[model samples]
Target chain A: MNNKYNIFLLATIFTLCIFVLQSVEAESESVYEIRNNQIMEPLVEGLPDPMNGREIVISRIGNCLACHKISSIDESFQGNIGPSLDGVGERYKEGELRLRLVNPYYLNPESLMPSFFQNKNLVRVEKKYSGKTILTARQIEDVISWLLTLK
Target chain B: MKFFLSLLLFSLINSVAGRTENIKGINDNLYDRPYSIGELKSGRNFLQKETLEMELDDFDNPGMIWVERGKELFNSVLEKNNLSCNQCHNTNKNSLIGAPSNFPKLNKDNISLINMEQQINICIVDYMEARPYPLESRELLSLSAYIAYKSKGLPMDIKIDSSNEKFFKRGKELYFERIGQMNLACNQCHNHLEGKYLRAEQISQGHINGYPSYMMRWGVVASVHRRFQFCNEQARAEPLEIGHPDYNALQLYIAWRGSGLLFESPSIRR
Candidate 1:
C-alpha cells in the first residue's frame, strides 16, 4: 500500500514540475502584441527614458548616428545613408515608431535598418550575439520615446 | 591643457593635409569602371598623416620585417635536392617580380583559383617535398609580403577571361548581397561612402591592392582573407574560415575592380 502511495506522489510532483516550467517559459517569452503596422503596447515594466535612448542612438550598440544624421546633435561626422532623424517625431506616430524600431523589414522589404528587437531569421550572426536581439525590449521602448521627442 | 591644445592643432593640420576627395584612381579610362575614375581613391589616401608617413619610409615600415623574413626563407636551401626558391625564381631569366600583379589566377586544373600564399604552399609540397605551412601562419604571411613587395609599384591586372567569368560574376554578386544582422553589403559603405567617417575611421574604397598589409591593430601582416573575416565580424556576421573558395572569388573581384591601382602590399593600415 505504501509503495503504491509513494508512486502516486511521484507522479503528482512530476506533473506539477512540468506545469511550472512551461508557465515560466511563457512568461519570459511573452513580449508585445503587434497590430496592423504597430506594436500597440509597451514591452516592459518601467517607464521609457528619453535620456537613455539618446545614449543608445549614439552608442556602438545602436549606432543610429552611423547611418542617420541628426543636425540637432553636436557630434560631427554623422552619416547620410538613412533619412535624417530631424523632425521625425512630427513625421511618425508613437506606435508607428515602435514598429519600425522592432522590425523595419515589415514596412520595407529592403530596409537596411536592423531589427533592434527581433532575433529570429538573421543569418550568420556572430556566435557571441546568436539568439540575442540587438536591443532589449526596454531599450527599444526608450528609443521610441526619445525619437518621438525629436521634433 | 597643453596636450589638448596640441591635439586640436594636430587635427586642424590633418584636416587640411588629409583630404581624400581630390585623390584620383591611377587610370582615367578603366574599362567598365563602376565608379567614376576621378572619384576612385586608394585606401592609402584615407589614412592619417602619421600612418601615411610611416608607410612611405621603407626602414620605418613594420611590414618590411615580414618581407625580410620571407627573403631568408626564399634563399634557404632544402637538404634533399639542395634547392632554394632563389635557384629557380631569382634568376634574371625567370624573375618573380611583377608576377603577383596577375596572380589569384586559375590553377593548373583551370577550375580552382590559387592566391599567392596557396601558390607558395603548392611549391613547398609538390617540389620541395615538405609539408605546407598552415594558412595565416607567420611563415605564409611573410612569404606573401615578400612576393607582394616585389610587385609593389606594378598595377593590379587580374584577368577574368571566359574560363573564370563565372567566378567573377559570383564574386560581384556576393559583393552586393546584404548579409548579417547589420544588413550591410560591401557596396553600401565601400562603394557609396569611401571618404566618409564611420565613427573615427574613414571608409576606404574597398580595394585589395594591399594584401599581406601590416594592420596596426593586429601589429602583424594580414592576408586579404583575414581582413575580410574582420569585416564580417564587424557586421556581427559569422566569418568564414580563411582560404575559403568564396573569399578567393571576392579577392578576384576586388582585384579586378581596382585593376589599375598599384600593388601597395605590405602597406600599413590602422
Candidate 2:
C-alpha cells in the first residue's frame, strides 16, 4: 500500500509540473511572421492565435477596451472613446488593419491610437520598457485575427 | 474528522455572511449624497465592494503601511537642520485637522502654487536649511502621506484667487488638452464617463487627495505627480518628470475640482 501511494504521489507531481510548464509555454510562445504588406512586420505565431487575440482585445495588453467596445467578452465595462468594434470585420480589410495595427499614424497622422507593434518612434515610453513594443507581432496578428471574427 | 469539516464549513459561511452584512452597512451612505460641481463622490465610492472593505479596515488597509512609515519619518531628525518635522508641527495628528485641504493654494509668500509634497520640501529647504528632498523620494512621500493623513476627512478648501488663478487656468487647459499617441485628454475618461469602466477599472474623477496613496498594482505608495506621470504615459504621451511644472499645475486643477470631497490621504487604489 505504501509503495502504491508513493507511485501515486509521483504521478501527481509529474502531472502538476507538466501543467505548470504548459501554461508558461503558452504564455511565452509566439512566432514572428514576415508579412509583405504590413506597415511593420508583426511577430506572428499561428498556434491557436485567435484566443490570444481575444485576450488582447479585453486585456490591458492591447488596451483595445480603452477606446473600442467589443460585445462578446462578457466583461461588463467597456469604453466609448473609439468606435465600437462589434462589426470591425465588415468595415476594414485585413491590409488596412495591418497598417493600423503596426502604426495608425501612417494612415492618419492625427490619430490617437497607439502602434501595437512598432517601438522606435514612440514618445515617453517608460525607461524599462523603452524599446518594447506594446504587443508582439504575434500578439498583433492574434488581435487582428480575433477582430476579424467580430463581424 | 466529519465534525471538523462541518465546523470549518459553518465558519466559512458565517464569515462570508458577516462580510456581506458589513458591506451593506458601508455602502448605504457612500454615494447617496447630493452632488454638485466640485462636489463629487470619492474614488473610494467607486471602488468595488471588496476593495472598499480593504481600504476601510485600518489594520488591514495596505495604505496604512505607508502612513506608518510616514509617521516614523516625521519623528526622525533631518541630517541638515537637526530638526524633525515633529519639532515644529504637532506630533499628535489630530492637531492638523482641516490643514491639507487648504493646499495647492497660495503659500504664505504668494509666489507659487504648492501642493502637500512641495510644501514638505519647501519646509525642509526654508526652515530646516537642508536641501529639498529630491522629488518623489520615498522619504518625502512618506512625510507627505503622514502630514496629509492628519487631515483626512477635511473638506478640500483650496483658494483660487489671484495668486493661483493663472496656474489653475493653465492646469485646466492641461486637463482638457489631448496628448499622447492615444490622444486622450483627462476629461475624456474622468469627466465624461466617470461611472464607466475601462479595462474593468471604474473611472474616478482623477482627484489627488489620496496621494501619496498606495496602489495595489504598484505594491507601493506613489506621490500625486507619479500618478500623473503614469496617466500621461498610459495616454501614450511622454510622461513629464515627477515634479514637472505642467503636472504641478494639473494637480492644482484636480485638487480644486475635488473641492468638497473629504481627504482620504494614503488612500488605496487598484
Candidate 3:
C-alpha cells in the first residue's frame, strides 16, 4: 500500500512541475499590446534591462550618437541632426518611445529615424542581414528603459 | 594662468592657420569644403600627435621606400629610345620641384582631366615610344611618389577655369551625394562629423595635400585613388575604378581645397 502511495505522489509531483514550467514560459513569451502611441511595460523583467539598454544606445547598432546628441555622455563631439536627447524621458511617455523605436515613420511619414524593431522599406540591406530587424525585440525594450532614465 | 592663456592662444592660432575658407562659400564652387560653416582644415591637422611626429621623421617614414625606388626608376633607360623620365623632365633649372602641386589639368586634345600619373603615361607612350605602365602598378606608384616627393613643401596651386569647371562640378555633386548601404555622403562625416568620432576615429577635413601617403592600415604607400576605393567600400557601396575620370575630377577639386596648405606627400597616416 505504501509503495502504491509513493508512486501516486511521484506522479502528482511530475504533473505539478510541468504546470510550473509552462506558466514561466508563457509569461516570458507574452505579446505586448500598444494603444494610442503607448505600449505596455515589458512582461520579461530583464529584457529591457536598463544596463544593457545604455550599452546599445551608444554603439553603432543604435547609432543614436550618429544623429542625436545626449548631454550625459561627455564626448569630444556629438551630432546635431536630431534633437539633443537630454530629458527625453520626461518629454516622452513609455508608449510613445516604444512606437518610435519600433517604427518612427508610423507616427510621422518623413521621420528619418530608422525602425530598430522592424525591417521594411529599407534600402541597401546586405545579404547577411536582409529581412531582419536592426535590433531584437528585447534590445528595443532595453533601449526604451534606458531612454526613460534620461530624466 | 599665463600658461593656460598661452595654450589657448596657441590653439586659437592653429585653429585659424590650420584651415582656410573660399570666402564665396561651398555651393558656388567645387573648391569649398561642403557642410562647413567655419574654416576647413586638412585631415593632416586631425592626425594624432604620434602620427604627426612619425610623418616629420623623414628617414623612418615608410613612404620613403617608394620614393627612393621611384628615383631609381626615373633614371632607368628604356631599350626603345635610350630614354627615361630623367631624359625629358629632370633638368637642374626645370627640376620636378612644384611639378606635382599643379596637375589634373584639362587635356586640350580630348578635353579630359590629365593627372600626374596619366601625364607620365603620355610621355612614355608618345614621347619615349614605350608602352604605358598599367594603372596603380608598383612602377606607376613608385614614379608617382617620386614626382610628388619633389613638391614636398610647395603650396598647392592647381588651375581651375572654364576648361575644367564641368568636371569639378561633377566631383562636387559626387561628394555630397549619399552612397552605399549606409547611405552616408562624404560631407556627412568629413564635414558634419569633423573632429568627432566615427567608428572610433577622428574625422578631419577630407583634404589630400598629402598623396602617395603612407597609411598604417595598408602598411605601404597608397595613392589617393586607392583611398577613395576604401571610403566607398567602408560605406558598403560599390567602388568605382581607381583611375575613373569622375575620381580624377574629385581629386582636382580636393587638391584645390588644400590651396594654401603645403604639400606633404609621402606623409604618414593611420
TM-score list, all predictions: 0.80, 0.64, 0.68
Q: In model 2, what lDDT does residue B237 have?
A: 74
lDDT (Cα) of model 2: 0.70
Interface RMSD of each: 17.2, 18.9, 17.1
Q: Indicate whether candidate 1 or candidate 2 has the larger DockQ.
A: 1
> RMSDs, each prediction?
12.4, 18.9, 14.5
Which residue ranges in model 1 land beyond 4 Å of their true spot? A1-46, A69-87, A106-110, B1-33, B36-38
Q: lDDT per residue, candidate 1, B16-114, as tens digits?
A: 233222223212332355665466677899989999999989999999999999989988976577777788787575578888866677888888888
Candidate 3 contains a number of clashing pairs equal to 3
lDDT of 3 by residue, B1-270 (tens): 546545744653443233222112335644544533236576678888888887888887788888999999999986588898887676665588898765777775856888888888888888888988888888888899999988888877776788788887877767765555454466656654567655346778788888888889978888898898898776655678878897898888777766777789898877
Which rank order by DockQ, best down to worst? Answer: 1, 2, 3
Mark the regions of model 2 whose C-alpha exceeds 4 Å error after superposition.
A1-62, A69-84, A88-149, B1-35, B79-82, B91-95, B107-111
User: Each model's DockQ?
Assistant: 0.18, 0.13, 0.06
Question: Can you write out model 1's per-residue Cα lDDT over A1-151, one digit (the tens) per residue?
Answer: 9999999999999999999996654343424445788877776668899999999998876899888899889988787767899999999899889878875755765566777875545567888887778888878888888999999
- Model 2 Cα lDDT, one tens digit per residue, B26-106: 233322222365458778878878878888888888878778888998888877769977877874553566778666656
Best prediction by DockQ: 1
- DockQ class, candidate 2: incorrect
